[model samples]
Target: MSTISLTARALLLDMDGTLVNSDAVVERVWRGWAERMGIAPERVFAIMHGRQGYSTMAELLPARPMAENRADNAVLLAQEVADTEGVVPIPGAPAFLTAIERIPHALVTSADTALADARMTAAGLRMPDVRITAESVSASKPDPEGFLKGAAELGVDPADCVVFEDSAAGIAAARAAGMRVVGVGARAASLAPTAFAPTLERVAVTATADGGVRLAVSP
Candidate 1:
């Protein structure tokens, strides 16, 4: 197992590609939206991950008024919640979640509460005790609001939390929140996170002799 230093008292995790496999459902729903809006599906896909639907729609449909974009985004989100069949846990997510439950952990996601719950339930993964959804933050990923809110809800200092993230937005949020970040996907390598592991399955956390925890990434 590979190892890295961690100075945190808690863990903050991102829900989508980091812990669950909802890419198919996300892409499908966004593709439909792209068709309806006459936007490029690939462009929509590129901007939507780790971002709020409203934020994504605003970015994708910049010509549209915010009210119109919000309405369209709500429709798409409703469709996704209604069609949650394809959502599943990422490989080893169950085991990783179980392992971390012994410690304080929170889920910080760009998704709102309803969609976050739907995806978590569909994946058969237990929701974290403390969760900061899009509804809980005025600013989203790459802004640090979500991660900071999550740490606050868990009653931990931002510097006392370790964040597990899969996207550049999330990594930026964690870093801005003064947390150590473990990047958990191929894209992670480019983010220059504190540690980069291919998947959560390859990550391990253990108590250190100094009474803090150490995070390890298995090669």
Candidate 2:
């Protein structure tokens, strides 16, 4: 595919599946929960990505009380911290992150603050100074709240921001925020992103003369 170029004043990035690869632990948690709940693992995985644990629980166990869902979500969060078995940064993500360090960037994730912290640490990714976690927004991905909050906190207009995401929910959120999105994985392509890449291996970030950031996304 031809390269896609994007220039923006600020960057918004998703944590899981975008910058970090924690598929093993994420799948393990959901599959275990699915089995215990007498639901299919496929059903759990389908709604698990780019969404808050509580939200996923609510969707999975619709008849359950909010209080019960909250308690179960807490347990999931705790398990995530202790289970980083296959956590690692995506290929070329370290350099890509360094290249944009001087620019206005925020980590916007559906995971809770504590869970995001643990996973990022396990993947050897330095936590960004600005972050929008599950607790940071009343509504989660597919709602546009987190990305909107991230852009606002970075003092950049939504149109001036570029988002990196790997899931349909996150991609939808970025688009809803009026930001151009660079889809980060194979699954992202089906979401109709502005740019799509299977991995960050060939992605390039350059600082433009006008103090803007340029992302050269290669296939």
Best of the candidates, lDDT: 2
What TM-score would you give candidate 2 relative to the actual structure? 0.96
| Model 1 Cα lDDT, one tens digit per residue, 1-219 | 456656567889999989988989999998988898788899888767787777888776677788887787778778888888789897878988887777778999988788989999999999987888877988768889998888888788888888988887788888888888888877677788888778878877776565446677754
TM-score of every candidate relative to the true structure: 0.92, 0.96
Instruction: Give a tens-digit lDDT track for model 2, residues 1-219.
Output: 799999999999999999999989989987888899999999988888998877888888889998887888889888988899999999888888888889899999998888899988998988889999988998878899999999999999999999999998899899889999999887787888899888988688999887789989986
**Which ranges in model 1 have alpha carbons more than 4 Å from their true place?**
208-212
lDDT of 2 at 130: 98
lDDT of 2: 0.90
RMSD of each: 2.0, 1.1
